[model samples]
Each structure stands twice: as structure tokens, then as C-alpha cells.
Target: MSLFLIAGIALTGFLAAGLGTMVGLGGGVFVVPILAVVLGVELKAAIAASAVCVVLNSLRGSSVYLQRGLVNVKLAMVLQVSTAVAAIVGGLIVIFAPVQILKLLFAATLALTIGVMIARPNGGKRVKSGPDPYGLRASFDRPDDRGPAEYVPQHVRSGIGLSSVAGLTSGMLGIGGGAVQVPIMNTVMAVPLRAAVATSTFMVGITATVSALIYAGAGLVDVAVTVPAMAGIVVGAQMGGQLGSHVPVKMLRTLLIAVLLGLTIAMAADGLGFL
Candidate 1:
């Protein structure tokens, strides 16, 4: 592409990475839409590029969260197992399944999630004061808190089940699964939103790495497009990570809800051939 086009793509990556890291969406959600719709790139190529950006964005963002003790490594590892396996299943299903139908289903799922989240906006931050059976409990200091907040991850089996679905969608859609993972971790699993976001940041890196490899193997990755975008994502992720560490939890929650709403609309439109 031309230098001007390269510059524009890098700028897009910067903005996407910043927001994605802040809300734990791994940047793929924004990058895919911008690349495919606004920039007029082919859909598969855009997804491939987005997968690469998310990998780098998550890695960089996770490092910051880890340093601040916000990431729940144990919980992330446990969920990764399910997501990783389901991604392969999703890849295989693409051969026989109609993508439009899948999109509609995914959109419906997001809509339902949004309703649940709105109805129970404060449900995920509860800290259980008893023994933890799953050993997935963790604690972290919030930006606005006077002390650390402790929370045990509940409903792990259910979280695993949902994560598998997230991974399947990730594979089928060629995007990182962080959007679904964040809500499931926070809402269904009773993880604190900050920790859930941090953990999701870490988790998406591994999942995106797997996805990027698949795209690379398929010759869908465009190095020329990826290099510039990755450079921007790297810097933006650092900025986002720093901001995330200090941002108020209420603002973060609001932003996450808005993002889900937007994604719901986008997926529904795509399913209906309106986008």
C-alpha cells in the first residue's frame, strides 16, 4: 500500500489498541471493522491483520496489568484450556456451517448478555469471605479503593462452557474472543471487573497467537499491513494499560457495556447484509 495508506492504518491501530486494551477486547473488534468496512480491505485479510494486532496488543497490555498485580493468572490459565480447544472446533465447523446464521446467533447472545449485565450491573464485584473450592480466588487493588478487593471466581464450570463458545466464535469470526470472555468472567464467574479485564488481556494474547498462526499458515497475513499496525498497537497498548490501571471501575463498566452494544449492532447488521 502507499505511504499515506500505511500511515492511516497505523493511526487506526493506535486508536483501536488503546480502547481495546482499556476494555479488554484485544483490539481485534475495532481493527476488523475499520479495516474491512472503512478501508475497503477484504474481510479475511482484515481479520488476519486484526488477529496479529490483538496478539501484540494483548501481550503488551497484559505485561502492564501483571506488573500492577491486576491479572488473575490462575483463572486465566484455567479458562484458556477450554477456549483453546473450542477454537479448533470452531475452525472445523466453518466448513459445514453458514457464517450468516452464526453471526445472527452471536448477535443474539450479545444482546442477551447486555440485558443481563444491565440488570445486574454490580453483581460481579462481590467478594466471597469463605474458603474457595476452585482455588481460583484472587485479590487486587482498585484505582478508587482504599484497600485491595478480594473475590473468588464462582461458577467456573459455567465460565469454561461459555469460554468454549467464545473460542469457537473467535475461530469462526477470525477475531480475539476477549469481548465474550470479559463479560463471562466478570458476570457469570463472579470475577471483579478489573481483574476480569486484566485476565482477559492476558488470555487473548495466547488465543490470538493461535489464531495468527492459522492465518499465517493460510497465507492470509499481509506483512506490509501488519508491521506498521503492530508498531502503533505496541505504543497504544502501553498507554492504555497505564490508563486502565488508574481508571475508575464505574467508568470502565460503562464503557464495556457500550462496546458490547455496538458490537451487537454490528454483528446483527452483518448477519442481515446491511453492513
Candidate 2:
């Protein structure tokens, strides 16, 4: 590829990672579609490159959240187990799955994420004095004047079940599983949104790491594409992690929904050969 094209790809990675880090979707969601659709790269190659960048985005994003005490390490660790196992299955499937199927799955998942985000518009509600439900308690400083937010994760079993699905998609689609995890954590588990996002960021790094290794082992990863994207994501994720702490929760949710909606349409079209 020309240096100019490489620069453009890096810029795309930068924007994708920044938004993904801020919203906990993982940068691969944007990177995969952009590469496959706009840049006309093959679908599998795009997915492989996205898997690589997502690992960097999650690692860099998680560090900031960890420092700010937004991450629930225990929660993230518990979730990672199921995700890791599922990722292996997903990775194996990716080698044989049809390109059209993968593209449709990506669009379907994005639509699901949008529906979940809209269903539970309110988040970051303060916890009331009560008995421990699931024994996974998390707390973080509120970005608003609502004081510190504390909440116990309500449904451990459900979170694990849903997170496995997230991991499977992460491996197959190279989106890092955060798009699914955030909604499951915030809405289903009752963890605060900010905490959910942080935990998702931390969890995705592990999930993506497994997926990346699988893709690399299969020789699906393209260095010419992955190198620029990874470099951009490493920097953009740090910027996003800092910015996320200050941005309004409502604005973040809105942006996520809007972006997903557009991507859903584009990817679905691309999958059907309409793009």
C-alpha cells in the first residue's frame, strides 16, 4: 500500500479507537466495516486487522479506567473466563464461516446493541441500602453532581451467559465483545454505566488477545494493515479514556446509538452486496 493510504488507515483507526474506548464498544467495530466496505479490503483480512487493533484499544483504555478506580477487577476476571472459552470457538468458526454470514452477524449484533441501549435509557442510579444480591459490588465517582455511585451486580449467571455470546462475536467479528458486554452489565446486571464501560474495556483486552492469537496462528492477520491500526489505537485509546471521564453520560449514549445505527445500515448493505 502507498504511504498516503497507510496514513488514511491510521487516521481511521485513531477515530474508531477514540470513539470505541469512550463508549466501550471496542474499536474493531468501526475498523472492520471501514476496511471491508470503504477501503475494499477482503472481509477476513479486515476482521483480522481489527482483532489486532481492538487488543491495543482495550489495553490502553483499561489502564486509564483502572487508575480512576472505575474498573471492577474481580468482576472483569470472572467475566473473562466464559469469554475466553467462547472466543476459541468463535476463532475456529471464523476460518470457515462465509463472508456474507460474518457481515450479517456484525450488522445483527449492532442492531441488538442499539435496541438494548434504547431500552434502558437511564443509568448510573445510586444504590440503596440493601442486602448483597449477587456479591459483585462496584462503585465509582459520578461524573455528575449525583455523588458516588454504588451498586451490586444483580444477575451473575445471566451476565456470564450473555458475556459468552459477546466473546463469541468478538472472536468471529473482531469487535472485542464490549458492544455486547456494556449493555449486559449496565442493564441486566444493574452495574452503573460508567463502571460497566470500564469493566467492559478491561474484559475486552483479554478477549481480543485470545482472538488475535488465533487469527495470527491461522495466518489471517495482515501486518501492513494491522501495524498502522494498532499504532493509532494505542494513542487514541489513551485520549478516549481521559475524555470519557469528563463527557456526559447522556451524550456518550447518544453518540453510541447514532454511530451504531449508521454502521448497521452500511454493513447490512455491504453484506447484501448493496453497498
Worst 10 residues of 1 by lDDT: 90-99
Score candidate 1 by TM-score against the native. 0.77
| Colliding pairs, model 2 | none
Residue runs of model 1 more than 4 Å from their true location after superposition: 19-25, 92-120, 142-145, 238-275
For candidate 1, the per-residue lDDT at 105 reads: 60
Among all candidates shown, the one with the greatest lDDT: 2
Model 2 agreement with the true structure over 1-275: per-residue lDDT tens digits: 88987887788788887876676556787888777777777888888888877777677667878999999998888888999999988988888888888889889987877887687555535454467755567677777868877777776788888899999999899887776888788777778777888899888889988988999999999898889888877777768867988988689779778977988998898888897
Per-candidate clash tally = 0, 0
